[model samples]
Target: MTTAATDTKATGATGREPWGARAGRLLRAVLSWPNAAALAVAAFVAAPLYWMAATSLKPPEEIGTHPPTAWPENATWANYRDAFTDNHFGTYLLNSVLVSVIATLLVLSLSAFAGYALARLPLRGKAPIMVSLLMISLFPTIALAAPLFLLMRDMGWLNSYQGLILVYTALNVPFAIWILRNFFQSIPKEMEEVAWVDGASPLRTVLSVILPQATPGVFTAAIFTFTACWTEFLIALTLNTADRYRTMPVGLALFGSQFTVPYGTIFAAATVSVLPIALLVLIFRRAVVSGLTAGAVKG
Candidate 1:
């Protein structure tokens, strides 16, 4: 086997490794330990999700069989039919959609302004403020659940779409601000100055110049916030006690009663619940990848 170093030394006066040697080296790197570890982690995270989806398609007997099969023995769509018609998963789906959309929109709008300010404004203690905001985000959500519930109750906000949307927005804003602020800082300050030189106000500069350039960052932030709200269970569960207002995550939890849980129906509902989030990620995956790569390089 021609090792990369030996192959390079064997290169002719042209001073280039042979194409085959370079390809071999690239292939080895791709299969290196770090890459192997990454693939392992991916499989670890994906296994349960795939199991849920596969189980959803399986018949009841197959789902409970000992030494379970990785793939279904027999497939059926009865659970899916029952999910929408019998379990009221449709209402839960609609509520999740409404909350996720409104929350993402609010986060985008608020984070843009907050990020611009943190990135551009000359103010005292701004660095500390940013750090403080991030620290708040790092705190556990469960810690505030009780207080938030009480506050919402006093304001008559619980058990309603607005309450959940607002809570989701507030919970996600800090991280969004952090991401957008750093992303905004990556752009050349000269661009904003030029916009101002062209007689554009700050708001106009952002809408026309900054925002257009920040597309990837915006998409990344939106995807992050939307997924957080979409999959969040504790806050959604605590804030909305009414069956009608429960989101998809809470609905999936209630798929079976205390007496018995139907794994088939539960899996079916879970599969349905994941579709929106999966769709959102698939649609904006390129943007999320680009934004994260660029942010890492710049920051």
Candidate 2:
């Protein structure tokens, strides 16, 4: 009887599991679904980019061969070398960098001021102004292309960096204003008031107190504006006539015309073109997320 009772107690102890251990297992299982889904999505998105890179590295003969190769049979740097030497991609890259940086800076500066005023100042007709800006943004840019062309022609600004910058800034401002305005509104007014009480002027208050807090939103606006200008095709195509003046999009398109459709070189150029934006996102991912969330919440 004593031996049987001892065996029953041991069985009961073995059958019972601690609550903490069971809870941990359940939590891990629940989290695994989302983690697995996220990884799958990432893999799906990365596949095309990987393919582009692989094709770019492959030799010309292998590119159009039957039964596409997953990995390059003979990987070479010839495509990249040709992309620079044969296509003048170096010039195109410079133009793109200059145009994108300048345009982004101008848009951010102007938008910040406009957004700040709209959010904080008590100006008359502000509602109408905001409404008009929103309405303008909704209109298709294609509709204004003809008029813009004419205007640029009249001003002798066609094919000019200044002209491109102006158009980019104009096209981007409304959206920037809307974004920054919300971000500005999200900032507590009490902070500005405190700065004012400490003998800081309005401009100083904005520069010192507000701008720092709003860095995420500013970065978000700048990056978006830069990417848009960098990748702009229609306006760049229409305005720029000279190959030398052409931005990346125009230059890349012209690559087909210039050569026998150098797919390898084209892919190489494309990879280079996308690298900057990708790097920016990777570096400032936190700011981008915060900016997006803040803007959405405030809106």
Candidate 3:
């Protein structure tokens, strides 16, 4: 009996050792190859943005010097001060903020209702409507440029905030609807049923139960919409030719044209341009992550 027990123990140990060894080898291989490659790619991508920030801090002479300085000898706020004072950056910033915020709010509100209807209501031609929206999203905005330009001209909305807001909202709606519809569909019907059982109306149920759960999706939608509107160049350039009405993109273009590409000032402006969106993302990162994860899991 002792001899038999000893033989069984040896066999079990041998089997366990090989399996553990194989698992370790597999883990090492994964960590060494694809994971390492991904990290390297991320670093490479981030290098230019970091360089831009660093260059923004350098003196104009240093910026233009042969063999560029990776690090500034003496950092200064001169570039940023010059950027705001010389470039009319303040006005451009305000315009961008106003247009982006209003457009995002409108898109979110409209898309919420449209998404909920598509998700829950049994409307005629729902499939076709969704397909049409998808197709419209696929069409390049450049294709609509000439017609949209003519329309804006006819409406006398050229160089106006209203025109830009209208265009931004329209462009963002299809994406907002797609995202919010997926979110609404993921929400369990049981919650709504319970609300209804408790004598809540459809609107009340949606307001009290659904909207709160959909915050992540809403945040995601708002971020994307705002970013798109804020950075849009082609439409803004064609629609708003007046200096006072120009948003950041067109303003930045004008800034570029004013000088021989003042590297420090341009970088400073670019850095400032990135701050608002970065701050927004950081503030709502948790919601964004949760929304994205939930959407992926449910889908």
In terms of TM-score, the best-performing candidate is 2
Best by lDDT: 1
Estimate the TM-score for candidate 1: 0.86
Worst 10-residue lDDT window for candidate 2 reads 9-18
* Tens digits of lDDT, candidate 2, 1-299: 99877766655666664677678878787579888788789899999989998998999999999999998999999988988898889988899899999999999889998999999998999889989989987888788888999999999999899998999989999988988998999999999999998999988988898889999999999889998999988888888888889998888888866447889999888888889998999999999999999999997
Q: Rate the local accuracy (lDDT) of all candidates.
A: 0.90, 0.89, 0.87
**Model 3 per-residue lDDT tens digits across residues 102-216:** 9999999899989889988889998998899888877898988898899999999999999999999999999888888888999998999999999999889878999898999
Backbone clash numbers for all candidates listed: 0, 0, 0
User: What TM-score does model 3 achieve against the real structure?
Assistant: 0.85
Clashing pairs in 2: none
lDDT of 1 by residue, 244-288 (tens): 999999988888788988889888998988888789888889999
User: What ranking emerges by TM-score with the best candidate at the front?
Assistant: 2, 1, 3
**Local error of candidate 3 at residue 50 (angstroms):** 0.6
Candidate 3 local accuracy as lDDT? 0.87
